[model samples]
Target: MNEKTEELRDIFTNVTDGEETVTESQTATRGSLEKDERTIDERLENVIAQMRERYAFETTLTDEELIRVAKGFYDDVSDEDLASELEVSSEDVFDARLSLHLVESEADAPDIDLAAIRERDAADLDALADEFDASEPQIRRARRVAAAQDESRAANDRYRDEFDSILGDSELTERIASDVREDGLEDATEGMETDVSL
Candidate 1:
């Protein structure tokens, strides 16, 4: 590469070297590197690496099996977390999840009854609070929502973020928008019951 191109590369390295923040002077040049530096594949790989570092929980299962097991463990965890648990790449986790859906479709795996789980979680949390002999209002409130619900709160959060991104404008007047809002309201009331029965 030429001098300018080489200089750009050095700048990118500096930017990603865990610098505090991007300054105004670097913004324009930074944009070019940001646009070109990480491809979808590379970013995805990095995500997988980060995930693996985060969840490394104990499990003897293979990546694919581990993903399935992890899902059963919690409905709210990101596939990245699952990937980490399974000691695999996020892409692998994605593929495994897709396969799970396909198999679920064939087997008619019952859609999770999130409402029931939430109610159960609440009950369990209540019991735990009683058993512990001390109850904080905040703890009671949170427990009431997920006393026994499948650990899918994280998943629900992800979906919420994704939904918001897709919706973009918050101005909701359209019928579809109304429906979406209604669904979200119901979900909230149900305490993260996004894993409804299929």
Candidate 2:
């Protein structure tokens, strides 16, 4: 076993009082994206629980203290709320505060707009349909599908662009370059098949 695995096993051993022996398989999978391994979040939560016993007596902890505590409890509790309750500064709460705020606020807020959005006029919709020159139902369905496709394409393109940079090595050049040069070939073929099917 590597030093890190040994260290982790040691730490795990120190934390757990139960007669759980650290297996080689367990150490091998630690910090890996394997299904069997405990997630960093789960391991951290366990560690935090062990650590929290030391601070549990404090009625309130400061933002720094809250952050220190929360660093081991990522995505577990509301860091901001804990920070506030602990009398910690907003800046001291971790970098995930923004994401947490967005998520929490979104959850608490109404799903649909409380205020009504103005509906598109019949004439406007008709004009849009006419502009497309397809059957009204077909045009509406196609528009929705096209919008979704555009979003999917954009995401795929972004991932591919990032992948291209990493895959520019000489050994992978031919395959990646050919793939890029013939990009959208499958989609084009699928479109032809779809037209025939329809």
Candidate 3:
């Protein structure tokens, strides 16, 4: 009976010892996982802080400075070097390069002068159209509008000359001219038909 009691006690002790060992192993693993997670969080926070600093610095640059930095990037400078020099991120340097390229392309485009186009003669306009690789109809339309304006000015000048010529004549002659103009005799004469049947 004493031997049986001792064997039972040893079995109970062994089971408890196995449970304690497993619990300790589990606790150690959990602690290790928590430490790894904390390290990762710290590293991520540090990277985020650095990114914020770079963004703030990049935003402070003027457009001219950005263009200069972009130019330097295109001039074969390394991205890391440019970022260090400009105190901005490599991403910001890439964006500056794109913006500078857009600005330069717009600047390189030719400016159109519609007024100058309107003043050019048909032959000159055709030449211009050929030079600009434009369609003939567009050139013709500009020429037509310019010609119409010219005609209108010439008509105004003729009327002014007529009025001046009449101003130097007698009052009776001026009245006759005025009456003829008001009666539309100039237009009437052009449309009149002569009757030859008697």
Best by lDDT: 3
Instruction: Quote the lDDT for 116 in model 2.
Output: 17
- Native-referenced Cα lDDT, model 3: 0.48
Ranking by TM-score: 1, 3, 2
* Per-residue lDDT of candidate 3, residues 7-59 (tens digit): 97778779898443334444433212122333322433343344334333324
Model 1 earns a TM-score of 0.25
- For candidate 1, write residues 110-191 as lDDT tens digits: 3333344354555475655464454545344334234212222434444223223322222232445678779988877886
lDDT of each: 0.43, 0.41, 0.48
After superposing candidate 3 on the true structure, give the runs of residues whose Cα lies further than 4 Å from its correct spot. 1-60, 102-198
Task: State in Å the error of residue 109, model 2.
Answer: 2.4
lDDT (tens digit, per residue) of candidate 2 on 23-129? 55544432222332554345434433443453232224433453344442333556566567656654344322321111222222223221111133434546655
* Candidate 2: stretches off by over 4 Å: 1-76, 89-96, 99-108, 111-198
Pick the TM-score winner: 1
Ten contiguous residues minimizing lDDT sum, candidate 1: 100-109
Deviation from native of the Cα of residue 165 in model 2, angstroms:
22
Q: How large is the C-alpha RMSD of every model relative to the true structure?
A: 20.1, 23.7, 39.0
